[model samples]
Target: MANIKLTVEEMKYMALLQDLTGAVARDCIIDNENNRIIFIVRPGDAGKAIGRRGANINKLRRLLGKEIEVIEHADDLEAMVKNIFAPARVLGIRLAQRNGRKILYVTVDPNDKGRAIGKGGRKVNIARLVLKRYFDIDDIKIR
Candidate 1:
């Protein structure tokens, strides 16, 4: 098994998430290089954990001083990728081998492409961060 690890910032953000949602956080991964955080919550609890209108997440973001991304605990890795791209409608997502490492390629509706890749490519950056930390992928490209 690949031994997953959390940085000190990730642990701190985990505590913040718990305090915000009163929900148990299964795993926390902080990507300092990308400046984001990803965490897992119980099944069927993604909305509650996010709170009404994302108030919970907003509060945590303010407290932790980092961008926060949340996903429901999922067993299937592809589903997890889909979850991250929710609201944007990813037409297809593929995992391919590149130089002996995994790379994620995400396809979104042509019209919604800009949304998937936000201003300064922030959204795509977040997706790449989560993909690397949670899926153990090394690279990501949205095409």
Candidate 2:
């Protein structure tokens, strides 16, 4: 079996997420280079983790004193795509631009692709919005 190691911020994020949502979060990561954090949990748990309109998340941002990003997992294709582009969840992200258009491409665990895209592409849309705003990307594509 392969072992996965987590950084200090990832550990802290797990602690904070559990404290807020009482859910078991996995695959927590902190992108020191980008100054962001990411984790995985069921979509149903997202509301609790984020709080009412993101109140808990706001608190985490203040406490961490750095930018924070969350990726809610679902067990579907579109949801997985959304998860992949979630700045924090993306293990390796590459940006490509053409004709004044920007495209954000991301790679995620094969098993997680479905959950990232979500049902009927709802999650994908939301993730696209997030990527557009934060990364200024015109489009998000996952593999």
- Highest-TM-score candidate: 1
Work out the TM-score per prediction: 0.80, 0.52
lDDT of 1 by residue, 1-143 (tens): 13577678667767777777887787786767766777777777788778999999888888778777777766676677667766777888888997899988888899888877877987777666666666678877888
User: Candidate 1: which pairs clash?
Assistant: none
Error of 2 at 74 (Å): 4.1
Model 1, 36: alpha-carbon shift in Å? 3.5
- Point to the candidate with the largest lDDT: 1
Which stretches of model 1 miss by more than 4 angstroms? 7-9, 33-35
**CA lDDT, candidate 2, residue 125:** 58
lDDT of 2 by residue, 89-124 (tens): 545567789899988777766776765565665446
- 88 in model 2: Cα distance from truth in Å? 17
